[model samples]
Target: MSMQTSIALGKQYLLDTYAQVPVVFAGGEGMYLIDEEGKKYLDFVGGIAVNALGYHDAGLSAAIAEVVEKGLLHCSNLYYNTQAIAAAKGLCTLAGMDRVFFCNSGAEANEAALKLARKFGHKSNPARTDIISMVHSFHGRTYGAITATGQDKYHVNFDPLPQGFSYAKFNNLESVKALVNEKTCAIIVEPIQGEGGIVPATVEFLQGLRELCDQKDILLIYDEVQCGMGRSGKPFAYQVYGVKPDILTTAKALAGGIPAGAMLTCEKANEIFKPGDHASTFGGNALAMAGVNEMVRRLNDPEFTDAVQQMGSYLREKLVQLAALYPTLCGEVRGMGLINGMVLTVSPRKVVDACFERGLLVASAGYDVLRFVPPLIVRQQDIDKALAIVEQALASLL
Candidate 1:
């Protein structure tokens, strides 16, 4: 089908939510996506960090095809499946968590984590149901997740949100401490804020939060939806700082592009949710679990993670150079691993569009930050090409 025809049909039938780019991708190979017109665009955004292994991966594709051949895509949570069991074991081992609850999408994962925190808190005291989230943080679109999000813009027009949720200044320990009370049940944070401009939490801040949570008997949750699964040069972002949380939420690249999310819990928080407490019908379907098992296997390799670290440093060095070259158009360079951002003095949207027109795909976080989250398998050469296009885009803006 023609790109224009497909877009016209989508506009007529689809919900008016996303301001989508004017391209319809037909297929992908390695680090590039082929549009309907046979144009190849280097995909730096990686479907907003969902395509970790990149497109048409041999192992992931074979695993998914094997699942398809089995013809048992979903057995539901009523019965145990081997694929789910294997995936869970791999994830638990990598994350150092005792248990996991699978779901579809990052939003659902965050919802499950929030529910678990509330229930765990209620066991101690009914009034301890409040959750503290960091300011400028993005959780998910669901009621509970959105309410826990610290940005007012996301909450606007969605009135009468769930109460007992308050915002603390990002990286400000005092702000978090002041909000703590008997009613506070948990504190949720992103080690590196993806949607809020690729800001990494200070080491002292995360360590302090851990200490505070330990003293207050509150659950500390890490939302690794965008930064986990080796995106941070580690199995999870918490490992980067060596500060473990009681609960960790992950999705996006969790199932190798398959729609899946998981809320992993430490031993203490693992016992909070009984079988009847929370459940998802399509959470750990065999199809998604197959992908998960393959991804986890690859991510567990030390050599693979080491490459990610090296490439991340190479990408960061290139971005720092880009910022220096265009001082007027760029500001601070922030991020860890592949999930990096450059503060743009010019409008990020214009730069993004310019790159899109030049056969590259990038995204914007907040209003002025250009976010880059390429596939984990992205090589140094790919970084060179993407940054060349980015430099061109910046020059055009000038």
Candidate 2:
């Protein structure tokens, strides 16, 4: 089918929610996506950092296929399943959390975390119901998740958002301190603000929050939906700073592109829910758990995670070199592991469009930042090729 025809069909049937580009991807091979016209484009976006194992991972594919052949895709939450139990154990062990509640998306994972915190707060005292999130943070698009988002632009036209949620400046302890009170139930933050221009929190800032939460008896939640699952050179982004959270949420690459998410809670916060508290019908199905099992096994490997750090360093060095070459356009390079962004003087949308036209797939974050979140399995040669395309696209702007 023609790309235009596909786009027109989408416009006719789908909700007018996303500002989609005109491209009909037919298939993906490793790090490249083939369009309907048989043109190959290097996939740096990795489905917005969801494809952790790259395209057509042999082990992951085999596991999913085996589950399919077994004719046990989903058996409902009525009975126990081995896949969910194993997946939960693996994730909890890696996160150092006591238990997990599975869901279908990052937004759902965050929503669960929010509800868990509220329940925990009320259990302690009926008046503790407020939550403090950080400014410029991007939680999901659901009602609760959107309200938790700190950006006002998302809150537009969606007034009457869930109340008792407030915002504070990221990486600033004083801002968080000013917002905390006896009624505050929890503070949710992204260790690395993925959508907020790839800003990372300082070690001291995270440590201070831990201390404050401990002193005030407030729950500290880390929304690692975009930065977790080995993307930050570790099992969880909180591990990068040697700070843990009372509740941790993760998705995106949690199941190697499968639709799955999880909210993990430490021992103190694990008992907030009972059997009838919350549930998801399609959460932790056999198919998703199969993918999660294989993906976690690979992600848990030391060599695979080390490669992510090494590749990220190489990519950062190349970005720095590009910044030196075009000091007028490139302002700053920030991020850890495989998630990085280049601050630009020009419009990021124009650069992203240019790269797309040149057979490179990248994304724009915030207003003036071009983000690169290549698959964790991306190699040195892929980085070189991507850098070349980025250089060409960036030079065109000048």
Candidate 3:
């Protein structure tokens, strides 16, 4: 279908939640999306860090195809399936956790984590149900997730939200300490805040949180939804900081673009949830687990993660140079690994549109930050091309 026709139909039928771009993507190859008109756009957004292997990856495609051919996409969580079992084992091993609960999205994973935290706390004392989240953090869109999110913009109109949630300043250990009390059950944070303009947590802050959690017996949770699955130059962002959480929620790129999420728990937090406490029907669907199995195997490779670290450094250097060239237009360049953001003096929407026109796909973190989360397989040449278009877009705005 034509781009206009497709967009018109979408506008008429689909929920008006997103202000989508005009282009209609037909398919994707390595590092680029082909539009309906056969216009190839460099995809630096990586489907919001969901396409970790880029597109049309041979191994991922074959794994998923095998699952489809088996005709066991979902056998229900009541019975055991090889795909789910293997995927669970692989994820737990990769994350260095003891057990995992599968879900369908980042929001679901976070919801499960929150439930686990509350239940674990209740085991000790009923009043210890409060959760402390960071300011400017984005958890997910579910009721519990939205309530845990620190941004007021997402909470608007969603009144009478779930109680027992409070926010502290990101990277401020003192603020977190001030909020902590006997009621605090858990503290959730993103090692690298993805939607909060790609700000990474400081080492001292994370270490301090870990120490405090140990002392107070509070469960520390890291939401690596956007930064996990090799996007952060490691299997998980918390590994980079050398601080382990009692529970970790991961999704987005976990299933290599397939819809999957997981709430992983260490030995301390593993036994909190019994069978009836929480469950998801399609949480560990065979098809999604097949994708997860392949993704985890590929992401675990040392060569692959090493390349990510190298390319992340290269990308950061290029972005720093871009900021230097236009000091007035851009501010600090902040990120770890491929997930990055450039603080802009002008509206990020204007620059994003200009980049779209130039056949480069990027996204904005908030109002003034341009987010770059290219696929892990993105090469130096692709980065050069995308940055050229970004420079062109910035110049156009000027």
lDDT of each: 0.94, 0.93, 0.94
Name the weakest run of 10 consecutive residues (lDDT summed) in model 3: 1-10
| Superposed model 1: Cα runs more than 4 Å off | none
Q: Which runs of model 2 end up more than 4 angstroms from their true locations?
A: none
Q: What TM-score would each prediction reach against the true structure?
A: 0.99, 0.99, 0.99
lDDT (tens digit, per residue) of candidate 1 on 153-259? 99999999998999999999999999999999999999999898899999999999999999999999999999999999998989999999999999999998999
lDDT by residue (1-398, candidate 3, tens digit) is 78899879989999999999987888999999998889999999999999999999999999999999988999998999999999999999998999999999999999999999999999999999999999999999999999999999999998999999999999999999999999999999999999988999999999999999999999999999999999889999998989999999999999999999999999789889987999999999999999999998998798999999999999999999999999989999999889999999998998899999999999999778999999899999999999999999998877
Q: Model 2 TM-score?
A: 0.99
- Residue 254's lDDT in candidate 2: 91
Q: Which residue window of length 10 is worst by lDDT in model 2?
A: 1-10
Q: In terms of lDDT, which candidate is strongest?
A: 3
Ranking, lDDT, top scorer first:
3, 1, 2
